[model samples]
Target: EKRTLDVWLTVNPADYDGRAAALLIARDVTERRRVEAERARLALALEQATDAVIITNTDARISYVNMAFEKFWERRQSDVLGQPLTVLGAEDPEIVFDMQKTAMMGRPWRGRLRHRRRDGRTVICDTTGNPMRDEKGDLVAYVFVQRDITRELELQEEYFQAQKMESVGRLAGGIAHDFNNIMTAILGFGAMILEKMESDNELRHAVEQIVTAAERATNLTRQLLAFSRRGVAQVRRLDLNSALREMEGLLRRTLGEDIELALRLDPADCCVMADPGMIQQIVMNLAVNARDAMPRGGRLVISTRAVSLDDEFCRTRVKLRPGNYVHFTCSDAGCGMSPDVLARAFDPFFTTKPPGTGSGLGLSTVYGIVDRCGGHVEIESEIARGTTVHIWLPMVEAVGEAAAPTAEEETRGGSEIVLVVEDESMVRDLAVRVLSSAGYAVLSAADGREALELVEKLEGRVDLVLSDVVMPVMGGLEMAESLQEKYPHIKVLYMTGFSDRDLTERGRRVPGERILLKPFTRDALTRRVREILETAKKARTHTEAEPS
Candidate 1:
């Protein structure tokens, strides 16, 4: 085959004996030319690549940057040509040192990197830096490829935060359940003690003090339950805008004269299904945190808006679902938290204050309340740059006001057969004694499993089943489900210290389900039992009266 070969040739006229002579030299250059062309093609590809690419000198000074790098850094190639890598990032020193060390050792470095842009925005990047070398293995330059993963990291953080909050909530709920069971026994028996003692009894004063201490413990347990997302809140469909307006004065008074409270409420009613008191508590908690943050006084702005969270918006949030949301934000112009502090800001009992100054449950309670309402919570803070708490509650159609409690005449005693199922031995003993004293045949069981066995053996018809929501072996809901099949006519009265999502949803309760929240006084327990039995009696009478 005939072929053409590119060659380098040089000819000079001159030479031998001063006569006409030519000296010529020729060498092949085809491979060198082809290699140069290939290099140019690769360089162009890198220039247009989606990932940012930069070529730096041995000292890490930028020598060249591709188009992608220019756009990603928001800086021109000309401006950054002679600049050091620090011009693009004030990254963690350790990461930079490690990357440099690996590259200097003639190895490629790959890692997650923190970078900065021309606009001063922080970015996270998955970066790979390779030490480019000549054929002789001599180091020439450092070539780096970086993919911006800032948004990805944020989404991951949101997911992890949701998981952490949920785990903590479960722990808190468990603790509250245990505490509530103990308090139920203490308060129940104490009430029984006081009911018998005369008004002038000397030991009655000591017993009153004991009851007072137990009541205080109950309040603490209530707060813990609130943080656990299993709170016994009296929820109602509330308009966020109007609710804030009503709370503005309390917030202002709480902040005192130095701090200013501002409300930028949405004109459109932002209604949500939440406990009115819980809503107040959430706002109050945020306000108190803001006030403490700004000890020297700063502006605390609380804003609300009706927002629709689309799939894209909800995708990053683990617990959040796409829907209409009431966006409630509390922002403060004060000394904010550092990165370390911000990470654990939502943790229960995590506080930055001096000893005895804070309990650290404020934000956690807000977290639980929002979680219970099927909402999202986010806190953004930077040292000396202030803090902002963002809460998104699922919006609900405004219904009529919270239903008023049904009026019924109080009952002193009842002859109905009552079955009490409680896991705590002391609580069970207390319930048995109280119900037995109330002139009823009270049956007792340790838990759902035992209760089922007890029910099966009983020959007489039990009028009501008083069961604890949470118990060992089996839960109240499971027992109730079984009861529904076996005894459809028997009435059920559920007693719980904290809320149970499995029993019923957090906000909405079943219409006819009767719940007695602990630690109830003996009178409250007896009254609730009698009420359910009486209602059942009327129901049976009406059923009999109806023509078949």
Candidate 2:
């Protein structure tokens, strides 16, 4: 094998006793050359590394810095050389001292570290610092490795916030669903009592107050349902511009004369598939909130832009994906929120308004609506400057304008057989009383399985089945699927506590128009049942007249 040999040579010539003498010496320095080469390579690698590297002496004074470190700190190496760690504005003096102590003890100190720049900007990094020792075990220097993780930390915070919001939403939804049953019973029985009471009765006013309170309570539950994403949504593809323009008049009126509403809509088509009512709720809630903020005169600008988000644009936001979207913004020149208040803006029941003035579900409902539509919402505000809320809704292909709904037919009492299924005894009893009083044959069951058993024992014709959505043993949707297999042509209607969309049996869906919402008056209960039967009768007549 060939070996590299570095040599040092010296030659001398001298005259002694009139005679010339020459002397020569040579030595190999291969190992010394190899070590020097290695040191140069290591230095070069550190200088070119992406992560910032800093070197300090045993006393914790800055000795060297890589190019990356200079760039990360936005300073020149000349300015930082021979300076203490404090020169970097490390924020916490105690933390720095502790880290140094750990490093001096021949242990690595690693974790998230924050550095404050002169510009008042914070730089969060995943930092690791360790002491370097020589062969004699003497500590020589300390090396620090820091990777910028500021953006990553921010993204993690957003994810945690989203999880928190989801948890609160689920809690609110469960509570609202249970409350819906109580409201339905109260409203149904109270309305029936009022119908029988004389107009000049002494107790009429008290009963009316009770009914009014029930209605208002029902509305509060509705808001809670919205925040939980448990409200009914009849979604359809519609133009965003038209939806806003239609609401312009209402928004202006809601904002009052003090606040001027400005509509700056994009000329391009901004079509999106969404519930009209949900869209209306989003605008109205934001408008009302902005109006409250302004108290005095101010400008409220509502604008939309058809934007195409690329992968780069969506990378920072975990909830967003790259696609065409309508960038809807509502900005108001009014007193803005502080950082502390903005942090909890999407939390359910979190409000800065005085008690009884705000239900505190407005912004939370806005977030839930956007989330339900597979979109994202963001808000930014500064004290005394203004507040701007941005929403991104996915765009859909253009479709024709939706047709206006037809007028309702007359509601008339019928003698058809009706089956009502409900888990709540109060709601079930109220439904039975209301339908029986309307002159219809009624059968009731506690749950879907019980209803099926009742139907099997019946010998008469069952004209319609009205059932609640959620129940023990068997749910309404599962029972409906089973019944349809046996009696395919029997009329069926579902009444739910909240959210028709949330009802599904192994991914099965029903028509939104067929599902009725809870907290109905006595008249609504009878009227809806009659309407379904009437529609079924018309369809049967039309089928018979058609050519076979």
Candidate 3:
């Protein structure tokens, strides 16, 4: 031993003679070192990410968090290191506890979670959490990733709303086409009866009442068509202020005394290209919603102003374009909403109220009208603070002129040999009764096939073909094409419950043509028939007069 067998030492004697030296020397640790380095690299990567990343131990205690997590929680890394993740749930700790339990069981959880920011404001985040395990497959930790999906949610809601409107439009067009035909007969008969009696007679006055009722029905059908976006839009550039002023009295009556309705209209001419009737509907629907919100009675302020939106505005708000606009604001001092409710307010059939209380199509219809008119709607609401809806319509370069009144003579027309075609028996009979009473020789048919047969059998005496669009045994379009081919001089008046585009697809043109909507009044039917027949007569005369 004193001689000390000469052992060659390449390094320190202490390093070679460590307590665990034999075991450490027997192992090759290069792969182990690489694995550890990779794990650390992954941890660092997660920590530096912008999305808040958090890891909790199996006991639901905070194990690790990235820099983003620290900022999101507004806590220092040291403070949150060993703290329970439930600490982040100042408002509701159960949310974190539940999510941790789900993840610990090897299950993943995803949902919107509410958390209190450092400033005390509520922060909503879309969160996903999954379980983590060690090499032995033991439950170790939960990894959570959270993102602010507020804007994304809003866009999704808007997309859903658009789809809903499209569906409603199709339904509305179909109903209007059928309803218009019934209206035509009702109105036509009422007009004929009224015309035969003395103005002072009680029976004549009763008939006048029928005509008035039919007219109101006609207006309703038109509204449905407008909602469906199938009705012909007579869009004109008009001042919004003047329109609002005219509607003020009507709105006051409609809202009742419970609501204190106030109109703050800017005198500046805020011109927009839109149909007056459609605009009226937009205002009425918004007012109705405002009234519903303040059921207990509150201030409803309606204001209109000129706004010039820029790119900044467009970026901040969804579905809005940067341009000059006329903004209509409807504000109500009612029970406000959480962000969740506000996001879905425009969705069709989505209502906070119990069933049978609301259809939830009010706002959806408004959105459709605005979208169809090349405008956008924005809503702002806070719980207990009430709501504000802003509708922005594009400004027009020119103002619209006042509508010209029809001449007294033009409104009156003569009875003509009218050939009426309709599928519905009730609607067909109504047209026959109404037209016959109005002093016109009317022929009725249950379908287009019967109508064409009658037309073909009758020698050159048929004046006009009043046909329904959607019918069995050949539709109105096909019938019209067949008749027009043989009798080029025969004028066709298409009546339909469907939209103009629907008929156009059947190889028929509606532009400048006398296409009547169903459920029309006696006055409307007689007037339209007269106009069509007169126009046809004029055209035939013009053709004959032209040089060959």
Candidate 4:
């Protein structure tokens, strides 16, 4: 009988005897060697791939790591090999333990796992691990594949930012639309009253009150525009300390006799790059919030100082740039907020006050305005300790003195024919009455389409088109375009209850095109209408003088 072996064998016998009966035996091993070589090649290929490849023994000790894993850890394979799987930088140690237990149980584990980078930065990664077993079905090791998705996360963040901006724009537009309508009614009615009232009479005083109310409503619309980033910001270098000092009287009146308003301005000049109107709004809103927090009498301290924030200050803060800033601090000795409430305080429509008592937009508006102006905000509060809000606006090099108030011109009347287009019958009637009493011949239209027809029929006789921006059927913008094409001589004045962006596609208000917000008093309506008519008349005279 021949002794058979798996590999080739050779026999050699120098002296053949009873002791050396079977000299040598050899069998072919080429097939088995080739098979083993093929397996090794496949394993090497998988290990060296760009995706992170790692192998761990059944005990969860790391056995192998490929080039990808080595690069990911910023270490050589020798450093990671033989290390426990937990040492491979899983952010959550429990996660690694859970995965090892599952893999040891002969089940595959796969899911996202957060891991720390060589630089100590944390990143989320997609990970999958499968139990590797021998032919006898005993667990040998676990193979893991990981993919870095930092870029994917960055892209998602960018997408979210775009969506947020779009949503904010829409919200601002809607608010402006409604506000413009209300202003239109108020202003139209006020104008009619002013036209019929005799100077220095009881009726005149009532008309003045109506006008004041309308103006305040106008201020609110402007605030909405500021929050929406659609309002025209007259940016100038101004000392905040001076502004606060000037606003002391107004703040005292606003907070009333119950609340104590205190100022703690730093002696150092704290100049900022901001719109004076917007700054006032920010101060006013914060003060109002402080007042609300203390339904009973409380102390409100408004202060300003120059601040220099370092890198350490920015680590725990969101959306903050480390630099010098003019810090406006508003502190109130009133009911404070819990951690949970403080977290959501800056979010729009998130209010702690009872419904109808607050709009919840105050803080959000302040935040938006500050952010748009390249600033940051920090809030500190604890239950029963009261709250302090610190707003940091970027400091700017002072170039000029504080802005001076412009002189108000006397009310002027016009004789030009003006077309008034408004959907609301009451508003339109009031506008017609005001304009007629002011010596301007007015043509009224219920909507843009009606106004267009009137303009086409009247042709050159119409000097200006004062139309409501939002109306049923044809909108004001479309009508303006149609009329402008036919009669280039006609000037346009857009009126709306919404923001200026409602009329402009990209939030840019056209130059020379007057925009009047709604809820305006009779005086404002009359003043704007008179101004537009006079400007049109002046332009016409100038054109005639130009000699075409």
Which is better, 3 or 4, measured by TM-score? Answer: 3
lDDT of 1 by residue, 256-362 (tens): 99998889988887899888878898998899999999999989989998898899888767668888898999999989999898888878789998998888888
Clashes of each: 0, 0, 16, 28
Worst window of 10 by summed lDDT in candidate 4? 403-412
Order the candidate numbers by lDDT, best to worst.
2, 1, 4, 3
Pick by lDDT: 2 or 3, better one: 2
Tens digit of per-residue lDDT, candidate 2, span 240-332: 999999998889888898788899999999999898888888999999889888988899999999999999878766778999999999999
The numbered model that scores best in lDDT is 2
Each prediction's Cα lDDT score? Answer: 0.82, 0.84, 0.76, 0.77
lDDT of 3 by residue, 1-548 (tens): 35423233343334455553332224445677678889999988887788888788887778878888777768777888777776675456677777767866767888777777766556667889888888998888888898866567767766776666667667776676656666666676676667677888878877888888878777755655555556666577778888889999999988999999888987778899888878898889888887877888999999998989999778746767898999999999888879889878877667887787776667766776787788888788877678899899998776448755375543565567888888887677776776786688888887778887888788647888888777888887788888888888788887666666556655655653567666666566667787787778888899999999
Give per-model TM-scores: 0.75, 0.82, 0.71, 0.61
- Tell me which residue pairs clash in candidate 1: none
User: Over the full model, what C-alpha lDDT does candidate 2 score relative to the true structure?
Assistant: 0.84
Model 1, TM vs. native: 0.75
Query: How far off is model 4, as Cα RMSD?
Result: 8.1
For model 2, give the RMSD to the true fold.
4.4
Q: How does residue 168 of candidate 2 score in lDDT?
A: 70
